[model samples]
Target: MKKFHRDASTLVLTLISVLLLTVSALICLKALGPHGEPMPSVTDWISAVGQAVGALLTGGALIYAARTYSKQRQDRHEELEQKRQEQAGKIIVRVKHGLPDDRTSVSLTNPTNLPIFKMNLYTIDDDGQVIEGQPLSEEVVVGDYPGHAYTQRYRVHSAYAVFTDSGGVAWIRTSKGTLFE
Candidate 1:
């Protein structure tokens, strides 16, 4: 795994270096002489460098866009695996109808001896729309998780736990703790 990361990083760095060299060459070619038929000025070099930087940025953007397709596929795969794991029964607790906007608390457990990132619970409304933080009053965190991506830390739970006093109001008493509105 370490070797894979090292190789990926090296490949990225090499690609970036090649991109920089190509952009620099193009900039130099375009700015061979001064503009407006006058000898090149100090500003010309600056402009050339700026153009090269712009080209580099454009190339990076293109690369990122190209990678997005693969990223989406990987994300879907991870999500499926997570759902299957959840179905297999992860230690989780929930507190429903605890805020004004029907806010709920869904606590998840990482029992696979691994810590996950971007672990957010998605709830669907009755109208079939994803409720964002529009009616959220304030977000609070009662705990933190500091485990590695592949390490289990039950004590350090609540990976991305957030509490926003939404529209629905209620009280909850879980085996872990009690949350009130």
Candidate 2:
């Protein structure tokens, strides 16, 4: 689709160039008429109308090119933002050894430099079932710098854990590895 738009814009630019050249040639011919005599009034008027039409066509083509360029820039920006989000979503949590009742807490370190706000935690049972956890007494705010970790002690037991950030991006971790969604 991008290639198609580029090709179409190129074609329009070429047509505009041709139209301009034609109008210029007509004006030159009128200025250097045969035997120094200008063409009839009717022919001069027709040429003037043609020049006006050519100018309008060139203006339209330029507007189209500007719009196409703007759209392409916007699309590129959106694509970059999506990729940044995917990278930002890679928050990892390491659960310390011990059972949920052992006073051990799950620790999350934000490797990213951007702070994470309003983060939430959930759990997965041995049966691969998700159990929604209760909200923290205070909102979870994780700083972006490395070595910045947040740990929460669980009141209940679960085999696996899931962490979600303010952006609604979630990551699941177990003994196996981390899974992102």
Candidate 3:
């Protein structure tokens, strides 16, 4: 839809420029007589108008090119951001129940090829209290499974994992599997 709008506007601008050029050409022709005689001061005015039209066309072309370059750059940036988000989403947080000692286990799985740093995993109870919390200073590599991080036997309502991805973007993942930066 945006591309359609841009093309429409560009077409309109081109049409307007063509109309202006045609009008100027007709005016210059009218300034000349049937015997090919020039009118006083009319030739100079026509030359100035021609120069102005050329400048207008050049400026328009430059503006169009700049806009195209800017749009392409923006598209590339968006594509890179989407790829980063997919990589971050690969970090999964799961809460396992029914341990041998009746304690809930909070497991973090990083399946991506890159590692995550400054990891903090927290298990929250029904009353929004933190049941167990584990903070890892070192980076968690790919396929590094930190299983049974929560040692408490409390009933966990949800779990949260906060860490920085390989791209240096911080993300928060919940037990419900929602991820965001």
Per lDDT, the best of the predicted structures is 3
lDDT of 1 at 70: 50
TM-score of every prediction relative to native: 0.29, 0.43, 0.65
Candidate 3 lDDT tens digits, 86-159:
87788888888776666777778888878888787777787888764444334565665565544454767778
Worst 10 residues of 2 by lDDT: 144-153
Give residue 171's lDDT in candidate 1 (0 to 100).
Answer: 25
Preferred candidate (lDDT higher): 1 or 2: 2
Q: Write the per-residue lDDT of candidate 2 for residues 1-181, one digit (tens) a residue.
A: 8567666776776677667767766675664466757555776767766766776677667667756776786689789768656644556644454544454444455665555554554444335554344322124445521211122423333433355545556545442445555
Which numbered prediction scores highest in TM-score against the true structure? 3
Backbone N/Cα/C clashes per model: 11, 0, 0
Q: Candidate 1 or 3, higher TM-score? A: 3
Model 1 lDDT per residue over 1-181, tens place:
7446545655675587567769677767679574667677788878887777877776677566546645675678788756544422332334233434433443444344333333334333445443443222223222332212211211222222222212222322232433322
- Model 2 scores a TM of 0.43
Model 3 residue pairs with clashes:
none
Ranking by lDDT: 3, 2, 1
Cα-based lDDT at residue 154, candidate 2: 30
